[model samples]
Target: MSTQTGRCYCGAFHVGTKASPQTVAYCHCSDCRRLSGAPVAAFAAFDPAHVVITPRWPDAKSHAKGVKRWFCPECGTQLGATYDYLPDQVYMPVGLFDQADRWQPQLHSHADSALPWLHIDDGLPRNAASSRASLTMASCDS
Candidate 1:
């Protein structure tokens, strides 16, 4: 498999993964929206073992139980996250990708928390919360 690469805005941090992402999705949870400063946040998840980080993040914050978000100290760029619920995966912000278009969000998650004014007309499945099943149904390799 071809490797995917990304870096923080200031180029202070970099990451690469040889494994294709397992799933890509738009997250509307409050933490995601607040941190991204957008109505929705998009992420592509891959096996943690396949992810190689340069200048590893020493500072991380857990906005809620089980989920830890890491940002670049130099640029404050939200780099990636890890969820206790999915211990085996690492979620990277799609915007950081060098080829962002390579992975498109197949679903909208945490739909119940979405802002009323935000309307995504993509026609993708909207789930009330984390939906691993929905991702599998989207034909993504587990």
Candidate 2:
């Protein structure tokens, strides 16, 4: 019953999903931090089956065991994110929606690797490390 829409930076990759999401989490792992080029990366989960993707956007280079990324080939915009391991839903870059504040982060992952200078006092759960261990601690109550 839940439905949402998102698009890539160049609007080449458009997505329509019909799942609200079990929870949304932030990743502070080295890969995430480096890929996002930020202190952390934010992602919202959706059922992969409920997502409809428009393959007009350029393909992305993937790493990790079960994840793939989509971006604008011409602009190199970090347009979208997805996970194959879970296989039920998809994850979209909250940035692409311009509704970053609408969905609050459930936790801060990889607190163990967080930059010493960065302060994480968002009042959300803080995971000392980046592992399913941290994610288990972040089980969304909602």
Residue-level lDDT of model 2, residues 4-59, one tens digit each, is 77776677667766766556777666776776778777777665577676765456
Alpha-carbon shift of residue 4 in model 2 (angstroms): 1.7
TM accuracy, model 2: 0.75
Clashing pairs in 1: none
lDDT of each: 0.79, 0.63
Q: What is the lDDT of candidate 1?
A: 0.79
Q: What tens digits encode model 1's per-residue C-alpha lDDT throughout 1-142?
A: 8989999899999988898788888888887787888888888988888988797764787766777878888888988888775767888888888878879888888888889999889899888876766563111111
Best by TM-score: 1
TM-scores, each model vs. reference: 0.87, 0.75
